[model samples]
Target: MQRRLADNITSDHLSCPICRDTLKDPKLLPCDHSICFECLTQLIESSRRFNKFSCPVDRREITASSYTLSAEQWASSFPTDELSLLLLQTISGDTKTETKLKDGILCSDHPQNGCDFFCFGCYKIICSECAVENHRDTECNCKNFKNCADLAREKLRDAYDEIENLIITGQDIVFKEIDKDQLLLQSRQQIRSTIKKLKTIVQDFEKMINRKCVDILSKVDSVTNVEELKKRTEGIVKDLKRVRDEVELSKSLTSTKDILTVLSKIPESLQKNTDLLYSLAVSDNPIELKLELNEKFLNLCETLIDQPIGTVHVVPADTIDFEDTEATVCSKRIKFSSDVLPLRALELDPFLAIQLDPSESENKITARFTGVIIHGHSIIAIDNANFKVQRFRDTIENQFIDEVLIQGIYDITNIHENDDVLVTSPGKQSRLIRLSTYNSLSIISEKVTENAYFSISQLPDCTFAVISHSSPTSSKKRVNFDWSRGVTSHIDIIDVDGNVLKHFSENFLCEPNEFGDPFIMPLKSICCLPNGNIVVSIETKTNSFISCFNQNARVKWTYDLNDTPEGVCFDDGKIYVFLRESKAVRVLSVDGDLKPVSTLRLPNYFGDGYSLFVGRNLLSVIDRTELIRLYKLQSC
Candidate 1:
């Protein structure tokens, strides 16, 4: 008995219905039917009389309006079925000779059965029968060849494109190097020419000095004395000219062989200094070539004139070192530094204090400050009651430089090496706001959303990650405040423009109210680590924990706070968790062990710690009332 066509050729499904052959650049129509570009073009031409073509499989009218003017253009107007093309490339043994060689390798033990699945564990291919019989264990998980082939083709294409880009990059680098070499040669020639001109100036100065000295000596009463002075001056001029010539020769000895040496010195010449070598290359500072008489000329003038002749004296130029100019501008004090001691060992004594009370001169501060962060030289504080953000100079607590009004300011965080702050607002329409660190009044970027955002953090790449819920802000109620507050069902990773790049949800992970099984602690504060992982402080009425999630929002590890964890922060690979009930800040390592490093007790004035910020080697926290305290971090 003969096998059916479908049984013999597994890729029959990938073939075009009209041509009954493997697809080539298959175009998909509105009816979900795909056909080869060539076949589509022929169908369109045949139906030109009616100005309409129909799908071969669906028999639906394919209007000319749906496609473009030309047949090639019309084919491109529709989406290409890349899956079918990849399938055809895999089974037809065409396009690539490597694919043909790969097809020849069948199942080793069961040669009759084609190897369809790739076992990742054994790093070998196996037939369905063999996979079921020999590799039944989960460790020997197998991937279908059809899917793996498509992935392999995509990876190879990416690698090939990368190599092509590298070739272009390499060519550009070679051309740039060649240009630099030419520039280096030009610099060498210019410097040599300059040295020659300087030598000529010195020779001319020597002749002038000799003539002046002879004229002065001629004033002597004795003719023998005048003659002796002339001989001495002529000898001095000749020696000076010879020295100039020797110096010029020394400069000219820098041949093409010393091109590397010249190139190496190019950076020094470009630096801020009017040295002879630098002046030759740079046009900003002009060189002054002048030769003046030594102290001996002044003595000769005084003696020859007899009546204490008024002599012109040349003063030496002061040497300036460019490196020391910065220090000269302003003297810097010695910076104080000490080893970071354990939180328990160091005292949380109030290093600095600021009153968060409303001021008549500036924008009124809210009774409570929701979020506080020390970004660079400014302390950013969020006023949830007034929907405002206040900026104060970190060094001087009294100076209030700026204030920004946001619609619903929930929390604020600083982006890595960026001057913008990421603020979260859970309002009628939840959104993420990027406010300027300098001028807190302006909004740099805002991403409005339908869901209420709890907290926002910036990844190392400057993209933002926000914890939000699926339900609208209006759905929240005070009666179910605990459940509603912990309603952070999903974490959305978005770009500057607010486009959600990636997101993961807790819905499938667990039901919002369900507990004890798949742990569900609604996310409160979020902080993205230097690594792409995120640390979120999650809490319930009774239970609290700090969970670290990978880029995909999958929980990598979780450390139980035991008490109600309020705010979360990450700095220098350490995770800081604020315990609202315990009235302390717990520092823990993010490693596998999740070891508790140290604990910091809240100060007397701090009623319930709401927010914590760790940056610029300083720690700032917002207290219950109108008080913001700062502490200098020390570790041993």
Candidate 2:
């Protein structure tokens, strides 16, 4: 009833390496071969033993970042025999209108497994024989591979569609956010412009008011003096009164005749003065006006800055402390109080968050450990993956620029403000390497009894206490089946130029070296109190412990933690220790007390718990894979 596809086929299938199981998320290596995720992890785990893990197909060296898969399709949705044959026929030749052939193809490589191997990209084939020759390797990531051409095209097409939609959404939101600010600014500008115009109008009114007054004053002054003005008014009034009295009496009287003559002259003079004043007043056209401004303008401006970004309210405080029962010391937990308030609300626009490789942000520093040296507009990471210093432009969009060309070192373990980088390259030769921004790589000239991994603590300028685990060149004391082990089994103190600052060798450490990833604890992992003492996490194979030593390297106290203390760091005024075997991270107080764990969520990190680092309020935990997990401290 069902027809098989790959049974009598040529090409179009691959095999699995680990369980010989159907390779679902097949990743091709640089060797033109493919392996499953499980097989890849096994290869990485076996690196220390082999030192070189290569693809079985072409024998090219495999690194962690180079695995590739055309599509993320799962193996569970495989096609059946008859359906797979029909699908294969349609994919190979032309469309098959047969309704019976729709179930899809059964993978010939693992025909019994019933998984299909027809890659949406390669169009070629891969049987279930993986860990042998799969194509998802890093080299196959680019376009134009015959086998994965179709898949790449389809995936790229879909990615573009999503990115386009995101960009459109983001642009729209950004436009609105910008408009919000612009609207406020524009309103303020308009009010100021209107006020300026009003001031001009008020000045005109003042000019008119003053000009009218000046005209009246000029007419008064024309009379020569205040006494003259009084005399004229009296003369006119007297003349009018004499005429009226003479008229009431006999008209033939001599006084009446004299009053008539004075009256005529009085009217003339009065008319002349009145006409002059009226004409001057007409020309001046004065109108008194009072300055007034809209009271609401100022109030509107005062509220713009503290306004909410979106639906969220942002009331800024210089510092915030948690109000939780389990709150750690000095921890200020910033919770997502509500989705309505966004810290970066303006970023809510449909921006295409094309998650590019974050490694693309920070270039690989060539030295062992590099410190952030903020110079100009660039933040230089000195210890690049190679022996070259990689520089990143200090901006939201970090861009890589020129690098310092060097050789023989890939990282700086610890960097200080003094531009000093501590490099660790203890393959066969053991040396304290120091690289400065100005000078090249230089090795410390101090000699110890045994050459092993060393970590140092700086006490003062050019003076430090070195912690080493080497036991007196002990050919006399033989290492049994169980002995102290760690990359930095020994510790020492050195200056910026790699000189032995001070030697603090103590016999206080856990024995039978079961500890791993020693250098994970930074220099801050150990410190001295005001009593002139020191506390440090000593690298021990069986039981890693934090040891306190006096100034003379005399072991004073040791806190035996019941976990494989692989990586440790200090934060929130306390020491946080990571246990590899138990998969639990503990926060220890400076006084050798463990606190409760509240916010570390790492699940897929299957490791010996060896890598950890603290940044701002979040802890970055790495399982030595391509993926990194960030555990944020919860706020009270």
RMSD in angstroms between candidate 1 and the native structure over all alpha carbons: 33.8
Alpha carbon lDDT of each predicted model: 0.64, 0.45
RMSD of 2: 29.6
| Residue-level lDDT tens digits of model 2 in 1-636 | 123443322233444555465453556555545566556656555542334466655667643322332122221122222322333443344443233225544445544332334444454444332212364454433222224457767888998999999999999999877866664565567568877887898689779868977977786566445476467666656766665565565446577666676556656666765665454433334344343545785576478557753352233321222222221122232222111111112111111111125344356322233223333444444342344445554443336566654443322344535555454332234445555544333343323223443334344344444443343344634232123342123345655545654455333332223543333222224433434455566443233666655666565555555545555555555555566555656554554433332323244446544445543555544442333344444431
Candidate 1 — which pairs collide? 339-635, 340-635, 340-636, 341-634, 341-635, 341-636
- 493-590: candidate 1 lDDT, tens digit per residue: 88766678887775433224555545466666778887798777765455566666678645666555456777777887677777776577777665
Clashes of each: 6, 74
Where model 2 places Cα greater than 4 Å from the true spot, the runs are 1-419, 427-433, 436-488, 510-535, 538-542, 591-599, 621-636
Off by over 4 Å in 1: 1-346, 359-365, 470-488, 507-521, 591-593, 623-625
Query: Which number leads on TM-score?
Result: 1
